[model samples]
Target: MENKVNRNIPDEILASYDYQPFTSTDIEGMPVERVLPTFKATTGSNKLVDSLADLVNKTVRDGMTISFHHHFREGDYVFNKVMRIIIDNGYQNLTLAPSSLTNVMNDIVVEAIEKGVVTNITSSGMRGTLGDAVSHGALANPVIFRSHGNRARAIETGAIKIDVAFLGVPNADEMGNANGMDGDSAFGSLGYALMDAQYAQTVVLITDTLKPYPNTPASIKQTQVDYVVKVDAVGDPEKIGSGATRFTKDPKELKIAEMVNNVITHSPYFKDGFSFQTGTGGAALAVTRFLRQAMLDNQIKASFALGGITKPTVDLLEEGLIGRLMDVQDFDKGAAESMHKNRNQQEIDASWYADAANKGAMVDKLDVVILSALEIDTKFNVNVMSGSDGVIRGAIGGHQDAATAKLTIISAPLVRGRIATVVRDVTTVVTPGESIDVLVTEVGIAINPLRQDLLAALSNVPGVPVFTIDELQQMAEKKVGTPKPLEFTDRVVALIEYRDGTIMDVIREVKD
Candidate 1:
């Protein structure tokens, strides 16, 4: 637990680094500066492009970075379409940046890398074939993986200037006003894409439903868009919520969910008007279900629910149990459709959602956040980056961003079959232990020693067993036995950056 840098470093030395200012202006309410007139297109000419191929050949150039949002999740067809077009046109040396990469995006991206069409990549996470390829050194350059909030901060500060942003919308106007809340393929909030539209040099709106001029309640305004194109279908609604938004059927997952509920109900912040966030995993989603009944029993109504939007969250909003849904991304079709119909569901960009360097972030108002961990150590440090076998199987996601909440609860099982969830130390530190408040598992709940106030409040909660974090670790070890230590080489494969862009830790490539 040694300090990464000397705490006594002089202020002048710290100022020399590109340290982001903690203070930020309230830009959300302020009107944006007058639109620059240099790139304005004439009204008479057609801004709609005929095909993806022609669009890529014309707008794309060498050494430029392009981005895509993964609102479509597993069923997204737009990424493959755009990438195929780019590859066929002989483009080279382009950087591919996306909010995340699904299994469907792996094949085309791997081909693009081999063909030299894509030379760089930056994203929230990678999986399947593409993940394996990248880990094994498929590309010359190491991929850069960022948390959702950090990516937003990078885009806003010009650290990662985007040349083009190919956004897939379910509905749009002729002038490129778009949103995820309408049409047949509604996927909810376009929070991630909002950043691209605001900052990208060229923003293209690709959609299936074209409405009239000045589309009302546009998530992405027409003023920021440069071109519009209509396609047969932007994505499949059924696939939008696949895999990520499932309710739990397993007993272990349900038990974990129940424990998480116990922790929340006993916490001091579980009163009316409290705001919270949860992940998309089975257990995490179950916590929402359990919380619903608790809310009904207590007659408590939340002020807001934030993060990846799902059907259940939208349902709560519809029932008036939650006042608002502040979405940064949509995880399901129902949430997306709710955006079109519900005025309370607000679409916000990454910076407004959780950029620590921004003037103010929505996460600052969060009372509690329920997070998932791949593994947690006795010190309460979390590792959502590597797997039990030491493979890079997870993403940083919003773990660190939400850890800043007043009460951050990490709910996980003590053991997963033969692999222990609690260890002496984690494989990689994605979230510092100082930010974590409570660790809840099916076997027991462990409140961080730093949070003695929470310990006093929850000490007498019925049906919930509280144990020291060390006791939980011992229980896990007794059940599964200690795992063999991981062997890592000196070469730094990846650097985990905090929301403020400080190096929290580095990941080394596994020794073969």
Candidate 2:
């Protein structure tokens, strides 16, 4: 059946899950009351555990749902180490629930699914071999894909109840008080894990460094933690940021960034005390640099910068161009290290960052946000979850959540290699068109007709040509002729959830 976005959802899958397909309404299945997990009041000064095996054996059982956080990104070690223990114990019908999955987890996740240890899965996205395996119907159940805020909301409302949560931190005390801003393996705010720690029935903290009693400014408090374990290494901080924080040198990317800057600087939101967020990618990161110069020239100072913290964004914060940095997750070691030194760089939980039910998420207050897209349609719908080959390779991350900003700008090249970034219709509509305002490519800028006010505001952005989204789509199709459609089987492999806990779309198994 076709949803409001015109994406087809299998009727059988919808009936089985009792899910409502995506529509224009913001909250399709909005939960009325917030759920608070029952916690045991125990008098324990120290909550230290000896090993991962002991931690898993004590907390895990058959058919239980377990959760984890991916703040470490690709450098994570706790996921594999703990999953191996759970698999060795021969746990069956266990549900794997993580904030998201990175390349480091692909092999162990595949092994567990093959071993029947993990029968169900839910996360932000899948990648590499694991995505391939899921695409071919390797697991017994379809994965439930959630945005970062959606996962937080799900856990809080018992929609995706987590029996056991294994969270890794950079440093922790013997009593389970922890923070991600300290020690050698520091990767930044424990934002995603904060929800897991608070709501999970059994919370486990895995750390590489054991600090003294009362680890100051604990992001993960002792009251929320059930146990703590020390390991050789939790993750590598350097690799977590890697290529994402680098400045772009390519002319196409620079042109896109420049176009985005022109759109922002000329728009109504570029005044003093404006707030913004720069989503990940070379072009998105480069927007911070261009925006910085524009802010300087206009004598503007932003009230705060929100979303994933990065080096370029931190530079602005340090230079006093932005007043506050609401750090939900840090993308680079520089931003992670900055958290230790900068008082203005505040650590926030996922719920506080983007949960729609929270009423006051940072995204709601955002003035401008620069995001990237794998594919976009004339309607301004975005597809960042899948590729032209119909394979899952990207995460929803904060794409849907951050799109709630006053002015949401998508920065991307017209095409990538042979795949057209702008398509007739997105393979998946992760973020609907209403939230997106402008599309800035190297070729030109397109303001959604839905926002005639913005179109009028940005009518004559100097040196930046403007056109209709249809014109951009035609140019893209002109360069690379009409592409063949992707083939998919009847079986649904995953359910893509909107930030409000509604079914945005479904990913069926790719046809062989």
Candidate 3:
């Protein structure tokens, strides 16, 4: 039994998550509802627990929400290990909320969902077999997808109250003071997990290394945590950034990156003490390299670089080109290692990183942000949450929150294989067109009409062709022709929430 309540969503997309749509400008703060927990009296001793089973028995119950973090990316092992324990103990109808779900956690999640050990999920996104299962309506509830910022807002607002948070840190003391920048399994920046620690009813710290009491510079402090458990290993450090963040020798990506650099250097925001954010993709990473040369040539320094940090961003910090590195999550081993030695590379939590409901966020101060897109429409709306086929294949991860920057630049190719990236309408609208200012491609750069200042600024820039988003769409269609429209079912599979927690869009089941 599915129902619809409209708020100006397209007819092709259905809202079946009991959703209420609002104007994109409806970003005012709202009241929160929470299921608060009471704490037992303690006598100021170690909060160490014997095993995960002991931790679960004491804190978990049926129909409760549990959470995990993805700082380790594909190398994460905590999700499988803990879910296996919960399943074996026969905990039913529980909700699994994590910062994001990766391919490594897919099979275990599938098992949990099938056995009635889990019934609901909310996360940044899911992929591979798990995505397929959810897209086909294998669960009782539609999976809720959110941006990195929205997840923080939900946790804080008690929209999704976490009963227990099983956090994996590289090192922790007996009293539960932990950080991701130490010991053998260090992955760097416990930014996302810090929110869980601060808000969850019971916080469990799982670690491979136990240091002495009072670990200094703790990203997760003893005051916020409840128990500490030791594990054989938390994750594989080598796989932390195996493929996502890498240098590209591809000529096409380099051309797009160079064009982005030109747009930034000519923009009014590229001055001394300016701040920027760049993602961890081939072209987005290449933009950092190009910007570094420009910074040196112009003798300008940035105030800070923020978001899911990479090795190249760390390099800019080390060379004094960038003043500070505010890390919410680390993308590579080099970045993880940098947090240990660099005092200027500060660790921050997800809420402070991008929660739109908060008093303020770091993104509010961002001058320029370079992101990658799976698809973009002539209206400049971007989709990072699904493929051209309408399958749930991508994550909303900070795509909307960071777009609030003064200059939002999306780096993508004109065409991916036979698919045109610039379409008349996107398969999903994760980030509204009003927030986007420019799109950098190998062929040309498209400035959103909403951003006339950017148009005038980059009009005569040498070596970079400027075009309207409509022309870019025409250019892409010329090569690939109009693609066959993807077919979708009436059953809504997932709800995509904006950074402020409104139903901006929903994903429906794809027709076979």
Task: Identify the candidate with maximal lDDT.
Answer: 2
Candidate 2, residue 295: the lDDT equals 92
Q: Lowest lDDT 10-mer window, candidate 1?
A: 1-10
Stronger candidate by TM-score (1 vs 2): 2
lDDT of 3 by residue, 38-117 (tens): 56646678988888887888889999999999987898878788988998999999998999999999998898989998
Question: Any idea how many clashes model 1 has?
Answer: 3
Runs in model 2 deviating more than 4 A are 25-31
Q: Which ten residues in a row have the lowest lDDT in candidate 2?
A: 23-32
For candidate 1, lDDT tens digit of each residue in 82-119? 99898888889998888788888999999998999988
Query: Which should have the higher TM-score, number 2 or number 3?
Result: 2
TM-score of 2: 0.97
Better model by lDDT: candidate 2 vs candidate 3: 2
For model 2, residues 1-512, the per-residue Cα lDDT tens digits are 88878878888877888878877636534555767777678797888888889778888999999999998888898998999899889999999999999999999999999999999999988889999999899989889988888888888778888999999998999988889988878888999999999899989999999999989889999988889999999987667666446687988988899889999998989999999999867788788899999999989999999988888898899999999999999988888889989999999999999988776678888999988999999999999888889988888998999998889999988988888998889988899988899999999999999889899988877879989999999999999888989999888888888887767888888997
Residue 193 displacement in candidate 1 (angstroms): 0.3
